[model samples]
Target: MKRRTKIVVLGSALLLTAGAASAATASEAPSPRGAAVSEAPRPHEAAAPETDRPREAAALTGTAKLHRSAGDDITFSFDAHLAAKDKADPMKATGTFAFSHYQNGDGARAEVAVDCLLTGGKVAVVSGIVTESDLPGVEGKRVGVTVHDLGRHDRLGYSWAATGTPAEMDGLPKCVSSAPFEKVAKGTGDFTVVPWQPEF
Candidate 1:
């Protein structure tokens, strides 16, 4: 016709440039061995942080009967045990502290062993040393006591209650105590003191 219409329009422009160069070489191929090809999506992960814990050590028994200032009449007891807050020896405690004293016929009795124990709530502050004694010169010496349960009016104090003269207090070192004041004319029991923490 007009030269076969220009050779059929140059073979339809070389079959439209070989179908766009075979779709740019199959989009730059690379994905055949078990091909699944299709990925782009990932991002999500982050969380973790919180910690703090440590504290426990407290126990001091009781048996009271204190009333000083003139009538004199002491008789306190406790079976202590405390020391473990990372313990660098908060006086490292153990147990035992039994005392007795009268006034009329003059009396004395002692037995300490524990070593430093301090509390805050029900109040407590026990020192120790006197292994055993009939009270004279306070056996080995190194006492300290102070209670204050106060439910039925419990209270006591003695570093050797009113010893020698001017309100003496012949022993007191480790954790030196004092602050149950005094006053427990005659109690039966229940002074389970508990509260404790770096407190003095």
Candidate 2:
């Protein structure tokens, strides 16, 4: 009986040891559905190329005269530059904008200090505060302007054109304006614009 008991004890010890070893092995093994691991680039394959993106620096300098009718016309000039590193007024600009409108034989002109400028492709939107004006109620008011350089077919638009509503004249924000949809007069002037993608 004593020898039988001894054999049973020995067999149980070996089985427990084997079970513990098996559990450890299972724990250390990687699962087939585990998280993916990134592989190193192949020797013959070139590294992936980065996407092309536009820089934040841009410049726009142009002048144009647009005719509205036989005796009405609008002329403007812009010398604006943008190098945005943050969101602030003037958009880091050192530029000026001048506009003139002639109706029959009467004329009015306004000069502005640039506040903001945004450009993309051949289009640019500019906003400024009127520093001097011959037009009534325009001085000290914010105004918006837009321009499009289409080679010989440049266009321009203004927020204060056509006597806008009180909200439009008083509540216009920086860097906001309408599209440049008005056509430039043939042989009147030309516009040159350089645009860049703005980081929003």
Candidate 3:
């Protein structure tokens, strides 16, 4: 009877030890569904809000005029009043140019290059060529000018083209010899221009 009692007590103790070991193993194992829940953000944490910003302005608008001196040595005078699209400051420039006149199959051609400085130390360099038709009429008298901007090496620059009819002038150098030419011309038309590209 005494030995049977001791064996029963030992068996009960072993059963309790097995139950504790099984519980520890279950606690250490990870649950498949709950794994992702641990990585989710807490309710109080939030993402930053975005804010609005202003964009940079581009392009300038204004009027310009070009004068051609009639003689064997043809010369050009250029002037313009420019207003920046982004700012209220007004800019003015005056430049002198040397041109070559030639007779093309279609008509007369004039090519010019100019370099000038603005009031505030800004530089303006222009290169252009113009053509006049040989036909008789408004079309024949019409002059087409193509202007290009030689941008500053460090920053972008601007350019424009304008054309007008000849008018009488009071003060100008006399033609070396009597020739058929207009004395003065005012800007009456403008061509759409694209903004100069920035230089890296």
TM-scores of the candidates are: 0.30, 0.64, 0.18
Runs of candidate 3 exceeding 4 Å displacement: 1-72, 86-122, 127-200
As for TM-score, the candidate ahead, 1 or 2, is 2
Please provide, for model 3 over 86-187, each residue's C-alpha lDDT reduced to its tens digit, 9 standing for 90 to 100.
Answer: 223221211222222222211222222222122222322332222222222222111212232322211221121111221111121211111112222233
Best of the two (2, 3) by TM-score? 2
Could you report the Cα RMSD, in angstroms, for every candidate shown?
39.1, 33.8, 38.5
C-alpha lDDT of candidate 3 relative to the true structure: 0.23
Candidate 3 clashes: the total is 0
Runs in model 1 deviating more than 4 A are 1-56, 61-72, 77-79, 85-98, 115-130, 135-148, 155-183, 186-192, 195-200
Order by lDDT, highest first: 2, 1, 3
Ranking by TM-score: 2, 1, 3
lDDT by residue (10-91, candidate 1, tens digit) is: 0000101112334233344565688687453344322222333443466567665655565545566687768556344547
**How does candidate 2 score on lDDT?**
0.63
lDDT of each: 0.58, 0.63, 0.23
Q: Candidate 2 versus the native: TM-score?
A: 0.64
lDDT of 1 at 190: 58
lDDT of 2 by residue, 1-200 (tens): 23211110100001011123342333345545756874555867743444434334666676767766554556677877775453233377657777766555565677778888877788888887877765566678887788888888888766755444212368788878776867888875566666665445
Which candidate comes out best when scored by lDDT? 2
